[model samples]
Target chain A: MSGFLTLLKRDLLLALREGGALGTALGFYLIVVTLMPLGLGPDLNLLTRIAPGILWVALLLAALLSLPRLFEADHDDGSLDVLALGHMPLELVAASKALAHWISTGIPLALMAPILGILLNLEARAYPLVIATMLAGTPAISFLGAIGAALTLKTRRGGLLLALLVLPFYVPTLIFGITSISAALLSPAGFQASFLILTAISLVSLVLGPVAAAAALRQHMQ
Target chain B: MTTDAATQTWTQRLANPTRFMALSGQILPWLTIAAIAVVLYGLYLTFFVAPPDYQQGETVKIMFIHVPSAWLAMMGYLMIAISSFGLLVFRHPLADVSAKSAAPIGAAFTLLALITGSLWGKPMWGTYWVWDARLTSVLILFFLYLGLMALRSSLEDETLAAKQTAVLGLAGVVILPIIKFSVDWWNTLHQPASVVKIDGPAIHSSILVPLVVNAVGFSLLFFALHMKAMRNEVLRRRVKALRMAEVEQAARGRDTSSATAG
Candidate 1:
């Protein structure tokens, strides 16, 4: 248990020290949001209407950009091999790494999402719900993403293939996330249903992510 | 131990590439006959026997193609998922081959479904497409098939590709439900109530019978195609092995010649 926290802390520190992945994901997310209005035309009504979906999609892509950092650096440096032999189970190790990712990458992305919402000409009332939905939804991105990252850890077509494999799984989260926010904005009465669904997706991914990642890690190592 | 050995032998016998080839070769002709006959009869039923819909008139014929392909598309993925589980848990020797072989068949069926559905949509919805739940979900299913195939092809090492894709394939289980629900939830939130359904109240038994027959025919076709593809994969592996042996022999011969020259 302590080891889990220690591993999580170490990964968080490494992510902060490197600052490369974190910065790039944030930059990419910001750029995508900024570009939406230009591409779709400068229609404030249009922007506000589509803001939640655009934000959710961009959040997903940004989180995807950070996935390779979850395992590639460790695998490349050979610590993954050492970690494979550690006292803590590989499942726990995967869980710790993904937890660190959620805290470092996912949380920051979620925090920045509402700020980016303004650029999309989002409704003032939607600000809180956008942040909340993103915060709830982004963990699924990090956690479920760990499975794809681990599977592609040593493959040649690393980044693109990782996107292809992981994006479909992200669909439900994207659906529920966007729907929940839209529900909140349109009808807060219906918000709980989609929001609860969003929460369920995150919790399911939170548990299944490490288990699947550990399995992929264990199998490929053989 | 003897009983265990007996059960193991049955699995080994079935899974052995050489044996699979021979058995499937024998089964292939019969499967082809079954596919052709059933599909012929099903087509006859679809066009001749099945009554035209009161709503769709002629476009109702499209369901004969669309629904079966849609059914097969989903079933094909289910088959791959089962094979993935087999590879991961049971370590079935042929599971990887089964998963790989099913992709093209599955993708083709998915594409057929989409095209046919679009054709049907033109007359019924007065548009070529509708972003309804079922159609959207099937499109996602098509993408899933493509992803599996892409992941398989990208890696150079056969063994590594198999292991990686098996894990990748297993992870795909989560998407199936999303595909199932994308329509209902989409409808719930923003009902595309304008587009009429193919399987509406107007579907008489005459229309349904041919649809069922055509579905059975397509199943036979899927089975035949699957067996033929699986056989080819087994043979491809054999060709790979023989080539590797030839390369090793050439290397050894070069070594001996170099030694003599020295």
Candidate 2:
């Protein structure tokens, strides 16, 4: 519906005006990738072998850093209360917010992943696979984080708790994302399975996540 | 509608806190006895009765413990999700107790699975730990259990703790499918499922019969322990209330005594 799109646009515009919200995530991703080679030593072979994991992990953490702000701003300013009372179903509202989150955080991370992939000396063949996996996997991050953000909306010390609740859910996406690239680099025949699985996970999350988030929000407001 | 009288009475009886407590208290010893007996028999069958694996030899014995423990870990999370749904939908007090009790039991099962897995891995895989799909996902489940328990403890309000934990419980469901499908998704060295397949359990009955028995035993063990733990939680709540009441009484007495002396 138009309402959902409008809500998504509003969220995106808000993130744009905030200035450093998007920058901070990318900066964290860049720094984590830059630091890995220094700590792991400058062996190109070693870097290449491990680059997929490092890239995937950095993307995951960067995606996670943007999660707490998803609902905190709206909740703090009382916009969330207004939104809750609006005409749209809460699940639709949650879906819109999650889409906005993916656009602001997940897209930027996906765009920057390739540059970091190069820094870690990833194989040229693996670049497309890395991008593809990040594209497929990051939406799930936003969708799932909505539940965490909703649960901790008014709780004290929510940031630490948010990380605790969300990270375990992140493991599968992390594994699949990294494995896609690894499979691509190691054996071309198997990479397709990983990609398909990642896609399947994202599709399932996309459908189920908004409903779960709406449930959490309903519980919170009560 | 009056509905089924017998079934309604059973639910009503369990819903009554005091009656449930007394009933569970009476049944606890018997369930505990059954659990212990079954587990011991399972262990005996695991070691002496089951034939050694042709390829794996003695190391396969580890599967008896590891497989059951792992199965229970997954089942525990499902229980959490179910109890959580009950809390949110039905507003049942017992559901909250069930969810809280499940966390520690789940954590214990997770640890048992990990340890037995490592013991098996040492001989089979030549290493105890790998970032493989099956191992990693299960480890994440263990951490999820830890996080749930931590979240429960961090909140001061009982209602808030219960609500927040239910949310976490529901959110954790996302991992189940991933855990189930990770082997098919990735090129991990871990072997694929041997039981609960579309074609039925892949392993022969010789190995699987004891495995099922132990699995049932472990499940019953979880239920019995969980019921006892929930009872403890209720008692703990009561004791806290009683202590707070006594403190208030003492404070009032002190104030009255001071006023009279003045």
Candidate 3:
């Protein structure tokens, strides 16, 4: 457990020190949200109706932009090899890195979402729901993204390939996140069910992601 | 001890790629003949014997192809998942070949399903597409297949690629059900409240017979294609190995000549 925490702290420190990745992701999120109204014409009613979807989709893409770096940096610097040889299990290493990714990248993306919501004319009441659903859903994104990052660790130009591989798995998370927010905006009754399911998806990915990422990393190490 | 010995020999024979090549060689012609014969018979039945639906008329005929393709699409993924398990857990040499060969075929069938489905939808649903739950799920399945193929092709290392692809395939299998469930939930919420549900017509004996025949025939065809693909992959690996050996021998010759000069 201490080993996991150390690795997590190390990763968090690296992300903060580097700082550019998180900034680029947030800027990308802002750009994508800004482009939507221009593309569709500035119809406030339409923007309000589709705000949850735009926010969630753009957030997924933003999270995806940083995914290829999840393991590439460690692997390239040879720290991954030392970590692989450590007392800690590779699965735990993967989990810590993914958890760190969620903290450093996912949380910031989720928090930035509500602010971007203003640009899309997102309903005032929906802001809290959007923030809540995104906070719950982004862990699944980071965790699942770890699997893609690990699998593509040795590939050339892996960013596009990682997107293709990881985005399909994001379907359930995206569906639940957007639907839960919409349900809350439209009525109170359906929101709880969708939100709970979204959280369950995050938990399931939290477990499955690390194991699968470890398996892929092991193959690459071999 | 005798039974154990017998089982060992059986598995050894099955596991030997050379023996597999010979065995599949013998089976291929017969499988091909059977698949072609059955498919022709099925198509005849579909066209000549079955009556058009009362409601859909000619458009109903599309179901004969569309449904079977969809079934193969799912079955193809199942085959890849099982083969991946065999490769990863049992270290079966042929399992990777099976998994690799199954992907393109599965993807092709998935594409067929989508195309036929939309063609049917245009005449029936008055549009070429809708975000219907089943269609959406299959579309995602198609994307999964593409991802598997893309991941495998991107890596230059064959052995590592095989293992990585297997890991992804298994993850896909685990996630498929959740994706289906979520899509269904999303569809229900967004589906227009008053849209009349169009339940499928009851399967009459006439329609049922042709459908079953086509399904069986198509399944047979899928296996034949898979077997043939496995053969090609085996041969390709053999060629690669031979080329690698030749290069190694050439490099050794150069090293020996240089050593002698030194």
Candidate 4:
């Protein structure tokens, strides 16, 4: 457990020190969310209707953009091999990486979503749900991304392959994430089911992601 | 290390590339014949015997091909994963062949699903494509197949190619569960599962019999095609080995002749 925490802290610190790793994603999210209104014209009602999908997609792509770096740097520096042999389990290492990713990528993206929400002319009432759905959802993407990262760890083109492998797995989360927020805004009762399903999926992936990733990492290491 | 009795194991028997070459060579023709017969009969039953869906009409005929092909596509991924596990754990040569052969067959199945789906969709949904969960996930599966095929070709070393492709095949298996649960979890235009329900398949027997027959036919077709593919790979590898031997023999002759001339 301590080892896992240390791994998590180290990755978090690495991400923090690596300038623009987190910022680039947030910047992209901001640009996409802000630019939509410009392209679609200033219609708050229309924006409100499309805001949830736009926010979800922006976050999805942004999360994906940062995914390759998760394993590439460690693999290059041979830290990944060292970690593979460490006293800690590979799954723990994977979990810590995912945790670090969520903090570095998911959390920051969630925080910036609401600000972008305003640019999209989203109502004040929808802000919480948008933030809430993102907060619950983006971690799943990071977790799923970790598996792809592990699989393509030794591949020549890890980044592109990572997206190809992971994005399909992202669809369910993306759908639920967008739907939950839209449901929250449009109909209160419909929101809970989607949110609950989204949360359930995240929780399930949270448990399974590390194990599957570890299995994938083991294959690569061998 | 293997005694004659030990050769009874499927893994052991298939481990010998030459053995697989011979076995598949003998079986291929018969398998092909059976596959053709079943598929033709299945298609006949699907078109003529199976009653039209009240909701979908003749357009419903597409389900016989589309749904079964889709099922096989998913099943092919699972097969690839199992073969990959075999390669990783047992380091069996035939396991690599199994994974290699299954990919193109899976891709073909996925393509069939997509094409037939569009054909059905045109008349039923009034559109050739919808960005629904099922359709999108199927598309993604197609891409995964393409990725695996591309990855296999990108490597020069045969062993490395097998290992790398195996890793990818295992990872791609994760998409299966997500696709399965997509309909139930999300509010999608795609209808919920009617077959393989918690209770039982809701489908009526009139349509169900032909569906099952076609499903079996498709599975058999996949097996037949995969065997043929594996045989082709074995032949290709044999030719490569023979060519390498010839090159080495030529090099030895050149070395000997040059020494004599000197």
Candidate 5:
């Protein structure tokens, strides 16, 4: 556990210090979100209606933008081999990296979503729901993304392949994330059902992602 | 030992690639005959024998094609999943080819399903497309097939590519049920006029018989195509090996001559 935490801290430190992954993803998110109105015109009612979908999809893409760096750099530099042999297991290393990605990219993206929400004319009432759903949902993106990152770890310039492999898996999260926020406008009960389903998706992926990624890493990491 | 002997015999005998190649070569002709016979007969039955719908009229004929292709679309993915499982868990030699063969076949069937479904829809539902759950889910399934093919093609290492794609292929199996559930919920929310439910008892016996026949025919067709593709893949790998050996030989020849000259 301590070893896992240490790996997580080291990755988080690296992400913060290099300042590229997190900053670029957040900037991309801002730009993508900011352009929604410019593309669709200044229809506040329309923007607010589509806000959850726009926010969730843009957030997913931004999260995806940083996914390639998660395993590629370590694998290229031979650090992953060392980490694989470290106190923690390969699966734990995978989990820790995914967690670090979430902490660095996911959290920042989720936090920045509401700020972008204003630009999209998101409802003031749905603010907490948007943030809450994002927080619950973002881990699944990072964790599942680790599997893609691992599978393509050996291929040069594998970003497109990673996106292809990862985005289909994002369907459930995107559906439920948008659903829960939209449901909040209907009833508390409806919102709870969808929100819980979204959380279940994240937690399920959090477990499956690392194990699958570790399996791929073991297979492909030469 | 005798009780287990028979089971092991089939497994051990076919497990060898050479053995599989010989057996499949012998069986391919018969499989082709069966596929052609069944599909031609099925199509005949579909057009002539299956009674026109009292409601949908002749437009219901599209269901014969659409329904079977949809079944194959789902079944193709399942075939890939099963092959992938074999590759991962049992390390079967032919599993990668089996998985590889299924992707394009599955994508073609999925495209057929969407197109036929649309044609049937235009007449019945008065619109060619709607965001209903089944259509949306099937569209996603098509993308999944494309993604699998893309992943397989991008990697250079034959063994590693096979294993990695097998892993992704297995993960996609989860989407099947989610598509079912989400689409059901989505259609319920929208409550549009459904064309033919496509599932329940509303399908008449005349239509049902041809539908079943076409489904069996399509399965045979998929088998024949899959086997032929796998055989071609084996031959392709052999050609690749020969070329690689030639390249290495040339490189070694240059190295030795340079050494002798020095």
Candidate 6:
């Protein structure tokens, strides 16, 4: 347990100290949301209606932008090899890195969604729901993205491939996240159902991501 | 105990790639003939025997192909998942070949399902596409197949690629049910109350017979293609191994000549 926390802390520190990774994802999120209005006229009502979708989709893309670096830095510097040899199991090691990714990248992206929501002229009522869904949803993104990151750990120019591999898995999260917010905005009752399902997706990925990523990582190490 | 020993030896014999190649060679021709015969018979029944639907008319005929292809598409993925299990857990040599060969065939069937589905939709639904639950799930399945193929092709090491692909395949198997469920839920949330279901309540015997026949025919075809593909992969690997051996030998000859000169 201490090893898990230590690895998580170390990864969080590396992400913060590294400087550009988080910024690039945030910048990409901002740009994607910013471009939406220009692309589809400055119709505030139209933007308001589509705001939840645009926010969630853009957040997913932004999260994807940071995924490739989740394991690459450690894999490159021989730290991953040392981690593999450590007392902590590789599955927990993977889980920690993924949790760190959620803290460093996923949380920030979710938090930024509402701010971007303003640019889209999002409904005031939907703001809290958007944050709620995103917070519940992004853990799945980080964890599932960990599998992609680990799978492509040794591939040259793996970013695009990782996106292809991971994005399909993101559909459930994207669906539940957007729908929960939309449900809350349209009707009060359906929101809880979708939100709970969204949280369920995160829990599933939390277990799945580490086990699968560890298997992939073991293959790479071999 | 003697019967158990005999069964073990039988499995051991089949596990040998050379033996597998010889056995499959004998079976391939007969399997091909059976598949072709059944498929032709199915098409005959589809065109000549199966009556046009009361509601859909001739466009309903597309179900004969579309339904079967969709079944095969899902079945192909299951085959890959099982083969991957065999490769990863049992360490079966042929399992990797089976998994690799199943991917493109599965992907092709998925594409066939999508195309046929849309073609049917244009006439029936009055649109080329709708984000219907089944369509969406199959589309995601197609992407998963593409992901598996792309991951395998990008990695250069054959052994490592096999293991990695197997890992991804198994993960995909676990996620498929969740993806299906979420897509279904999302569809229900967005869809209008009066939606047109493709398979209307209790298919009639006339429609059911041809659909089942085509399904069986297509499944046979899928296995034949898989067997042939495995053969090609086995032969390809042998050639690669022989080439590597040749290079090693040539390098050794040069090293000996240089040593004598020195």
- Which regions of candidate 4 are displaced past 4 Å? B1-3, B6-8, B46-55, B154-158, B177-209, B243-262
**How much of the true A–B contact set does each candidate keep?**
0.70, 0.41, 0.86, 0.22, 0.54, 0.73
Q: Write the per-residue lDDT of candidate 5 for residues B1-262, one digit (tens) a residue.
A: 5676566867456667777789899999999999999999999998778888898899988988988898789889999999999899988888888899889999999999999999998988889998776787788899889888887788888899899899888878887776556645664432332333656556567778888888889999999999999889888988898999999999999999999999
In model 3, the runs with Cα more than 4 Å from the true position are: B1-5, B9-12, B178-202, B257-262
Clash count for each candidate, listed in order shown: 1, 0, 0, 0, 0, 0
DockQ of 3: 0.90
> Which candidate leads the pack in DockQ?
3
Q: Which ten residues in a row have the lowest lDDT in candidate 2 chain A?
A: A147-156
- RMSD values for the candidates in order, in angstroms, are 3.2, 3.2, 3.5, 3.2, 3.0, 3.0
**Per-candidate TM-score against the hidden true structure:** 0.94, 0.89, 0.94, 0.88, 0.93, 0.95
CAPRI classification of candidate 2? acceptable
lDDT tens digits by residue: candidate 4, A1-222:
888888888998889898678889988888877778889998888987888788888898888889888888998989999999889989889989998999999998988888887777777888898889889987898888888777667677767777777776787798788878777777898899989989987987897778778877786676
lDDT of 1 by residue, A4-63 (tens): 898899999999899898999999999988888889999999998999899988888888
What's model 5's lDDT at A175? 85
Clashing pairs in 6: none
Candidate 4 docking quality: incorrect, acceptable, medium or high: acceptable
DockQ of prediction 1:
0.65
Per-model DockQ against the true two-chain complex: 0.65, 0.47, 0.90, 0.31, 0.64, 0.84
lDDT of 4 at A213: 81
Sort candidate 1 into its docking category. medium
Candidate with more favorable, higher DockQ: 4 or 5: 5
Return whichever of 3 and 5 wins on DockQ: 3
Comparing 4 and 5 on lDDT, the stronger one: 5
Interface RMSD values, listed in order for every candidate: 1.5, 1.8, 0.5, 2.8, 1.3, 0.7
Worst 10 residues of 2 chain B by lDDT: B1-10
Q: Across residues A108-200, which tens digit of lDDT does each residue of candidate 3 receive?
A: 999998889888888889988988999999999999999999999998789999999999899889988988988887789989998999999
lDDT of 6 by residue, A14-131 (tens): 8999879999999999999999999999999999999999999999999999999988888889999999999899999999999999999999999999899889999899889988
